[model samples]
Target: MTDRRGVVAKRAEDLVSGVPYVRGWNRARRSAGALADQLVLLGLDSDFPGLLADVNVFGDGLVHLGTIGPEAAELLANLIAAGLEAEQHDTATEASSAMRREAPAA
Candidate 1:
């Protein structure tokens, strides 16, 4: 069962009828989001702010997985769609980056 926030939705296949099961952009996006949330839970967000952003930035490319030359993009998008946190990672990263300063290299 999915929550009102759509944080936990039924598996994609259950939502679609008579559709062949395919691991695509949608799935990836969801996965990415979920991964983001998991990272937050694990406190990884505090240490690696760019982790989620990279996933989201790459996830955008997933939207066109099946088209010519779109396989890679699709893969990324799918990752984003599968996870909720992954989708919001870019914004979160930007916000955090603005609040943080880089350390001087030794």
Candidate 2:
């Protein structure tokens, strides 16, 4: 699988690097919520763990991000989207196979 969520992940990195600290991460809240909502819709409810992993990886690569808020929160949302996309892709592939087996030949 090529992992189709790479674009979202890249955007998150850009947001993290470019967006200045907002004292309390207010600017990143909406983006974060969007990510979380997308993940939930895609049925990967385990997004928080994946998000934490993503945040830790980001922190390790750069300066420690400290407590997640605002921008960091948005980054978490991106992580969730990435995870959901991956899972959904896999599930869709599986579903295609199942449907093929069940369908009558044309």
RMSD of each: 16.8, 12.1
TM-score of 1: 0.25
What root-mean-square deviation over C-alphas does model 2 reach? Answer: 12.1
lDDT of 1 by residue, 21-106 (tens): 34444565676567567657755444333332111222221221123235434544665686767658977998788767564456
TM-score of each: 0.25, 0.33
**lDDT of each residue in 1-106, candidate 2, tens digit only:** 2134222232224335634434223324545566567657865435343342222212221122235446546766787799899999999999999999999999
Measured by TM-score, the strongest candidate is 2
Cα TM-score of candidate 2? 0.33
